[model samples]
Each structure stands twice: as C-alpha cells, then as structure tokens.
Target chain A: MTLNRRAFIGTGAAMAAALAAPAVRASNHGKPRVIVIGGGAGGATAARYIAKDSKGEIDVTLIEPTRMYYTCFFSNLYIGGFRDLSSIGHSYGTLAQSGVNVAHDWATGVDREARTVTLAGGAVLPYDRLILSPGIDFVEDSVSGWDVSAQNKMPHAYKAGSQSELLKAQVEAMPEGGRFAMVAPPNPYRCPPGPYERISMVAHLLKEKNPTAKILLVDPKEKFSKQALFEEGWNRHYAGMIERIGPDFGGDNVSVNPDEMTVDIDGVVEKVDVCNVIPAQKAGRICEMAGITEGNWAPVIPHTMQSRVDENIHVLGDASNQGDMPKSGFSANSQAKVAAMAVRGALLGSNVFPAKFSNTCWSLIEENDGVKVGASYEATDEKIVSVSSFISQTGEDADLRKQTYEESIGWYSGIVSDMFG
Target chain B: MNWKHDRFWGVLATVAGVGLATPVVAEQQDARIGDAEAGKEVYDLCVGCHEVGPDAGNGIGPHLNGIFGRRAGSVEGFRYSKGLSREGRLGMDWTLETLDAYLENPKALVSDTRMSFDGLEDKADRDNVLAYLRQFSDSPQNIPESAPTGRAREVGLSQETLAIAGDPEFGEYLSNECTTCHRIDGTYDGIPGIVGWPEEDFVIAMHAYKRKIRPHPVMQMMAGRLSDEEIAALAAYFGDLE
Candidate 1:
C-alpha cells in the first residue's frame, strides 16, 4: 500500500482503490497531496492548475518565500520607465482563494525517500508528488572577485525585485557622461535575450536622462540571442553611445572589483560608474539537496517532466534540462500545464493528454519599437523538440513594431493572469 | 490530445461493455444520433467513391467502415491526398460533427479533399448520412457488429458547419495554452477579449488563422495546430464564459 509511482500509474480503478485504502489516509483524509516549491511562472501555474482542475479532490500546497512575486520578464520595462514596479508584482491571494494552500516560506531542504519538504520556518510537509520550479541560482565563485556579498555594490538584478529597484536607482544616479559596464553571463542562463533587453532599456533611459553616458558590454559568448535585430536597433537608435567586446576580443576574460568600481578585461583595467554582474547559473539549490540535479540542471522525462532520478518528483522551468525551449517565463508556464496533467492523471485517475509546448519572447529596443521570437514544441521520446518557429524581421514598418509592442503588453497581462489567477 | 481520450473511452466501452457509452454520449449530445433508415438514402451521394458495411474495403476513397471516432487518412494501404494526410498529422479525426462538415463541404474541411462531389446543403441530410455511417463505426453511441479500428495521431476540427456542440471538458484542458496570453477574466489590454464570442464566429476566425488568411503569426501558429474539433471545443468554452 505504498502507492508509489507504479501504483499511481496502474489502471484507473486500481488507482482509485489505492486512494481509498486506509493505511494511506492522510491529515486530509485520503486525498492525494502535492507540494510545489517556488512560486514563479512554473510553480504558480502548476499549483493553481492542479488545485483548480482537481475540484477539491487533491490537496495542493505552494511554498514560496515571497508573498508578492515580482516577475523577471517585465522588470526590464520598469528599468526603462515603460512600467512601474507595482505593475509587475503579483500576490498569491488569488491562488489561495482558488484552493491552493499558499505557504509563504522558503523551502530549505527536500527528503526524497520520505516524500517531505522542510521549510525555513521549521515546518515539514509531506507530499505524494513534489514539483521543484525554483528557477535559477548563481554559481558561486564562477566570476572571479564577485559574490553575493558584493551584490550591494554591483547588483545582478537578475531576480527582479529589490535588485531591479536598486539597479534602476544606480543607473539614475550615475555621474554625467560616466561609464556603465555589464558583465554578461556565458551560454545556458535564464532568458536568452534578457541581458540584451536590459541593455536596450538601460540605453533608452540614458538617452533621455543622461545623454552622454557611455555603455560597455563585455560578453563571454561569441553571439547572443537576437544579434542581428539587436545590432540593427542599437545602431539605429543609440549609435555612438554603446560598445561591445565579444569573446574574440578578451571579453571572455573578465573580473570586477565592486569596491573600486572597475572592470579588468583580459589584462586592461577600466573604471566604470556602475556594474551589473550576471554570473553563470544553475538550478536552484533545493534541486541539489533533493539529489535530482545532474551537473547544473535536473534531467527530466520529456513527456511527464518527472525527474530522471525519482518518478515522484517533477522538475520544471529554468531548473530542468528540457531541450530546445528557452529559459523564459512562457516556456515554464507551458511546461507547468503538461506536468499538472501528468500529476493529476497519476493521482486522481484523470485522463492525460500529449504534451504540447510553445514560447514567445518580445524585447523592446526603444519607444514603440519591439521585436519577437517564438516557436512551437512537441514532446518526443528523448526530449521536447521544436516543430516550427518564427521571428520578427529587421527594417519592419513602425506600425508593425508598435503592434508587436502592444501585443507584448497584452501577453504580459495574459501570462500574469494565467500565473496568479 | 482529444482523439487519444476519445479512443481510450471508445476502447473501454467496446471491450468492457461496461455501460460507459451512455455517459460519454450524454456528455457529447451532438454526437451520432439521427434516423439511420432515412440516412441510408442520403448516403447514396457517397456510393460512387466510398463504401461501408461488412464487405467494405478501400475504393476511390477509403472505405467508411468504422469511420466514427476514426483518425483522418489512417486507413492502411490507401493513398490519401497531401492535404488530408497533413490534417491527419495535425491530429484530425473522423467524428460525427466532422463527418457532417465533410459531407456538407469536403473542401471546407480538408481544402483539398479528392472527392469532387458537390456538398449536401441540408443539415438533416448531413446528420442522417452521418447517422447512417455511424452504423458501421464503433463509438460508444453506436454498437457496431465489428470492432472499432483506426490509428490515432491527434487533433480535432470542423468547417463552416455551424451546429457543432464541442466538448467543454476537453476545451478546459486545451484552454491552458490560451490562458497563458489571453486572460480568462475577459479583460482587454493589448490583446482583444476572446470571451463570449458567438461560437460560429470563433470557429470561422480560428479557421481563417489556421488557413493563414489571418495576418498574425502567433495566432496562425496556434490555430494551425488545432484540429477542427479542437477549434469547436475552444469556441464552445469561450462562447459560454461570463
């Protein structure tokens, strides 16, 4: 009567009978339980869908440290002045009202064998299924001379809350005509186009606020997400204000001194007014504690999103080594639904459908000038693979770009509603 | 995704004889119910290219035996048009509503169906022909003498046939993809409100996107993957929203 993954996947009647068995009766009285760690795009969507769709049949608990979730997707817009900080923040109240037991606390550790998660508040909760969508965490010491202790001096602003506000304040506080330097992360990080988009927003702000300020971008990668389109926009709008040093030109060899406010590229050292350091990222530490991650990420079964090491645990979003899809909010949201369906089918004996995933990423270069890239994905035996894709073309009409920008606004409203509500 | 569930229920009802058909059909009231005796005469239009019943096999078109709940273009050894094969890959299925649409206008459904017969304009004739064909199929709504048989891929669809009653349960699952970018609360910001549109308009607009007649790339990509039945389901789900 263990009701392991094998019993959960048995025929509907057998699974139903197992749920009715007395030995497995829980505090909720025989209802299957799911515990979700992290409450961003992936975790929030997964928790809400399971609770919303199960109709009180299953108990769902969402453990997130923040009561108000600030999305990283539109934080750049806040930096650029297109949106306010309040506009990008959402609360778990709606999800709680809709049946998810929202627990606002940090998940400190996971015990896979006992199927329990320990919170920072010293409460231990058990689960029939565990979903880890904790997003990205920086690889400590990956960047020389920089660590979390140095964050106050040089903000990463990658997590999108206080750090975003801090970054914006720093940019606004820069001295006239001062230099702004960004140490961009290497390949395999969150949001493929994020660093470039931030640069666009930063440039937009400087053009209006401090016209003569200089921007120095040091990249470890040879090329980035939307290189041609970004290059085209940068040249068109901020022609002489920005400079980039790619890996071919010693950009890969970089170090920053937060105390001195200087950057060393290969051997040359230069002083800068502000520094944004985005280090290499890995799956959040909870995945490592659960012993599910391989190297930097947790590998999952493409169809169910279940961790390869343990069937009862599912890894999602920026944390999972899913193929072809970018590490964006949209991809995580899409993956959440598939994982929710699989969990419901396993627990509630409900029908399961094939996994269909899609993602679209939009970046605004300047006022009313936005571009996008998107693709549709299907789960194959080995991994989720792209089936079809589309991207915005260069030199498009202003009207089209405006429409794309407006469309992105609509998308933000839509995705936030999908996540929070 | 829709067809897999349908096929699962179809197999369960056929093999277990477990009285699962009534609930399935009750949930989908628009499925296979008409005067089969009258449908026999209306099916004469299809006699030239298609055949059904015990001795039925591939003809000018694939045989219609066990057509209900069957995947489109999936008959073994029968060469199908590229358009129909593509639809099959896109997850098209042969269900009661889809059959009626195909009977009403073959080109409207597949856009390139090889059958050149003029469409039946009367809804009664289409319904009766589908009811007549239902006798040869193995849905829970009908107890055919032979077993249910067909390969399934995925997808659901329809054409200009406006009377389709989509299964909202299936729509709820598919709507997850839509709610990501389109608010379920019907709030319009940069994206238009899709809630409460007439089912007919919803179906037509989605078909236009599927055909690339619509201008938006994201919409075209989303609609292109949906089958006729899936379109009908979304229309039903959104049309009824408050």
Candidate 2:
C-alpha cells in the first residue's frame, strides 16, 4: 500500500505510522497540524510545548477569544488590594512571537468527522490533532433566578478580567456596615479553594475599608477544601466579620434575586449590598459543541488526556474529568505538559514518558497568613491516583506563613510565564 | 561536618543535666536540670524583648519558639546585629551549652549582641533560665519517642542510586513539576532559584527533601514520590539550563 499525502490525511495516525516511511512527512505530507482551542493555562501550555519541543516539525495554531488573559489564580489578591489588576492580566504576544500561530477568535463549532473546527469569524481550521482546554462555564440556570445577563447586578467574578474589577468596585462602594453575601458553588468546581479564598480577600477588604461590614457565605457542601485552615485564620484575623452556612443550614436550597439585591436561603430572604453568586459549572460550551462531554465534563484517559469518545481530540484543565486532580490553573498546567508530550509522541514519534501529576493550592487569609494543600499523583489504569499529599498545619509560625505568601507571589509569576511563554 | 560531634555533645549535656533531677530523669535521660517553675520567675527579666509560647511573635528580639536545634541569629524577619549574624554564619547553633554560655555573658559570647542584658552572676539563675528556655525548644535528643520531626533525614540513598546516569531529555520533561513555582530563568522571587545549580548539590538537596529532612512541607511531598532516577534526571536537566 503506497502511503500518499491524500491517504495519510484519510487514515488513522497509528495505521499510517506503522506503514509509511519516516521520511514521508518531510518529503510529501507537510507538518502534522495541531489546533489548540482556549488559550488559558491548559491550552497555552500545550500549544507552546508542542510548538517549542517539535522544533518546527509540527504546525501549531492557538484559538482564543481574549487577547489579554486575566489569570483567575491571583484575582482574589487584586480584590484584597494586594495586587494591581494589570499585574494579573497577561497578553499572548510572547506566545505568538514563539512559533505558535495565535488566532484571536472564538471557536463556534467542531466537526469531528471532517476533522475541522469552525470559528465565529467564519474561518475553518483543519488539524490532525485537536486540544480543547476551554476551562469552565456556568451551568444554565444552575442557580434559580440567575443567568449570564444578570452578571452585572450580581457579579460572578469566577472568570476574572472586567468582572473582577467590577466586583472590587462594588465591594469598595458598599454602604458603611453593609452586608456582603456570597452564594458558593457545589463540589467539583474550578479551584476548590477559590470561593473561600475570595471570602478571605473580601474579609480583608472589609476589615480595612469598612470594619463593620459583614460577609455571609452560603455554601452547598457540608465541608470544603482546607476548611480547618480557613476557619482558624478567620477566627484569628477576621473574628465576627464572617459567617458561613453549610448544607445543614439550608445553604444548598439557595436562590438569589439580582434585581432585588437579595438572597433566599431556606425561605429566609436577606438583603445584601453586593452579591457574589458563583453558580455550578460545566465544561466550556465548545466541548459540548464538539459532542465529547459526558454529563457536565469531558472524560479523558488519564495517561494522554485524550477524549474517551474521540482519539483525535484531547481535553484538559477544568474541562477534563481526569480523576483525583482538582480543577485549578496549576493542575491544568501540569496536565497540559503530559498531553503535549502524548500529542507529540502520537504525531511526531517523540519520546513519551509515564504521566506524573501534581497540584498545590495556596490561599491567603490575611496580610501575611497563608495556607496550602497539595498532592502528587500517578496514572493507573483506573484513574490518576494520589500517592503522596501534604497540607499546612493549623498553628504555624508567622514567618512560615509569610514565606508561604511570598512563595505564592513567585508562583504567580512563574505560572503566567510558563503559560504565556 | 561536625554534626556527629555536635550530637555527642548534645547527648552528653542531656546526661549531665539528668543527674541534677530526681523524678525527671526517670521520664527522659536527656532532661535538662534546674527548676523550670523557678525559671518562670527568672524569665520575667527577659520578657521585655523576648517572647515565648503559641502566639509568641517577634518583639525587639526574635520569638523564642523552636529555639532548640536552631542556629543562632537565623530567625526569619528579625534583623540581627553584626556580631550575632557572624556567630550564626560561623555555625553557632543554640544548644544547651551555647545558650547557657550566651546567657552567662552575652557580651563575652557575641561581642556586639543587640541584647542589652548584663551577665547573670548567679550560676543557679543562669541554670534555671536555661532550663525554662529549653522548655520552649523541641530537641529531638530530648524527645526521642515522639513522632520523627520532618526535619530529620530518615532515609539514606543506595550507592547504586547515587551512581545512576541521568537522561537530560527526560529531565527536561520531569522538570515541569518544579518550574511551576521555581523560575526557569533562575529568578528568586520568594522561591529559591534552581537553574544552573551543580548536579551533585541538586541531587543531595532533593534527596534530603525526599527523606523528609527538609523543613518545607511542599518540597517534601513533591520529592517524596520522585524515584532516584527522576531526581538524577532533574538534577542533570537543571544543571545544564545555563
């Protein structure tokens, strides 16, 4: 069987690799093309790795709607006045300069049969491999009487950028001694410690600007990540400033009225000055458009992050249902490297090592008080399983806490560079 | 390194201290001498600057928690005088003998110590104060039956592992886990730089963390799972970064 360029495009990669000569790519079939959608932690890292490691052997194109990406990891610090908004925002200029063809447009549709993606700008991109790391989107009507349109009245600063700025402005402009309410999301959300961290930042802000201002946290889960650490910090730093209602207190049965600026928790409606309603989450709409999601997320093989339904596409970050690892920027960045390696090995026959995964989350409770939780993981046939883990002890010295906070600053710089460059 | 010699001295001091106590010697052979109850009264004089306890924080002087087994003038966030900093640089650790000597004559030990205290003329007073200070420090020699502190290197490397030839290409791939917090550019922004380190030093440091010798919890957890070959690979990769 003669392996021509036309036949190479039609056949599966595995079959062609076994039959065709290695020089076939250089002689006739041009570089294997990879189209990575969503230029955030997962997509950016994957695209950059494939482009850089392949050494011009593979054509990589990154499709993302936002040119300046605002990282959600440090947006809470901005809310607490520890960082400037500009510091957390990054541009894709560096990535574009380094081999990757940056496409500033939204992905509208995916045709798995034709192996092509349609953009909102009416451009169709064909690829031998596709990576979808679209992060997360709020589930439609996940919270009663709330939708994306109501975001202006009740900001869900989960995605960062302008929403974060607006939320900060709203919090700052609240009436003296006003009430701030947060409707937290359920289990299996992006950044397991995010909502609690945001609360800490809000409490930090209130302590400075309005000491009498109170925070009401309504959470659906019975317990949360780093609950003991957060509780201890809250007691020490922001005593009487914050109150949390867990599942036992009808927190799961929550509804909000953005127009009325009120929240209904178990038939008790409370007026609030600013409401942060973080609704339940699902994989980005692009994953659903590609018809790869199961239930609310795209399930992928832990080893390669390849979609269970389609071998041509790999899902990453918050969109991927890779077991054990949380939905975080750090987790996404880690998974992206593994996926990038697998993609290169599949497309260009590069060395693919056994997949190793790890993640750590640091949350600031006050000025110099920080806590963290982390775990190292390895891929088994069943799932990515945690083998070793650690978390900050409740009563640590101020020096260690301050060191942790500084380390987080360094991590912010390190990760943004890792993702963008 | 005189680590073994230092341990012997620590054990000897503990034994000598045990001879002075009657009932306390039954609980631990390394128990310090002097009345801790009476030393509480002696601590009143040092309370103007020094602090000790759960919520103890740095005042004019550094907080005294975990002072045992710690190097002199090495507390974070405190600006040590030139004399104490030099003593710490010269490897002056605060053990039973060192602390007692410093307490006996601050000026004689560290010529330019910022501490403005006269020498304790009474031997009994110095003994009591040293015992009271020892209560705040957790010496591994004093508490051998307690859970092994994460600061001890419990695991040792096999000669075979120490001799493994690392693959640099594999090292680059494995380094992704480290570059999350450590800058590949070698910038030390709160986190220490790892790029361009000597391979041997890198391997030794990682193994120390792997063995739970390092104090950082995150580093311990990260290094705990890495195989010997993986550590060697990372060392090789980071060594060649420059």
Tell me each candidate's i-RMS in Å.
16.0, 26.1
Residue pairs in clash, model 2:
none
Residue A409, model 1, lDDT: 98
In the range B1-242, model 2's lDDT, one tens digit per residue, is 22332332232223222222111111111112455567789999999999998789999999998786589999999999999999999999886567778888999999999999998888678767765776675422112111112111112233332332243566787798888889889988888899999999999999999788987888997888676767888888998897
TM-score for each of the candidates:
0.74, 0.73
Candidate 2 chain A: worst-modelled 10 consecutive residues by lDDT: A1-10
What tier of docking accuracy does candidate 2 attain? incorrect
Cα RMSD of predicted structure 2: 18.8
Backbone clash tally (model 2): 0
Q: Residue A124 of candidate 2: its Cα lDDT?
A: 87
DockQ of 1: 0.10
lDDT of 2 by residue, A1-421 (tens): 0112332122223222322222333233478888999999999999999998889898999999998999999999999999999999888999987799999999999999888999999998888889999999999888898999999999999999999999999999999999999999986789988999999999999999999999999988876777788999999999999999988999999999999999999999999999999999999999999999999999987767888888789999999887667889998999999899877776766555556777888889899898787766655333454545567888999999999999898888888878877
Q: After the best TM-score superposition of candidate 1, give how far the Cα of residue B176 lies from its true spot, in angstroms.
A: 1.0
Q: Cα lDDT for residue A205, model 2?
A: 97
What digit string (tens of lDDT, one per residue) describes model 1 on residues A263-358?
A: 999999999999999999999999999999999989987767888888788898999987667888999999999899878767765655556788
Model 1: per-residue Cα lDDT over B28-105, one tens digit each: 111124446678999888898898998898989899886765689999999999999998999988865577688888
Q: Give the best candidate by TM-score.
A: 1
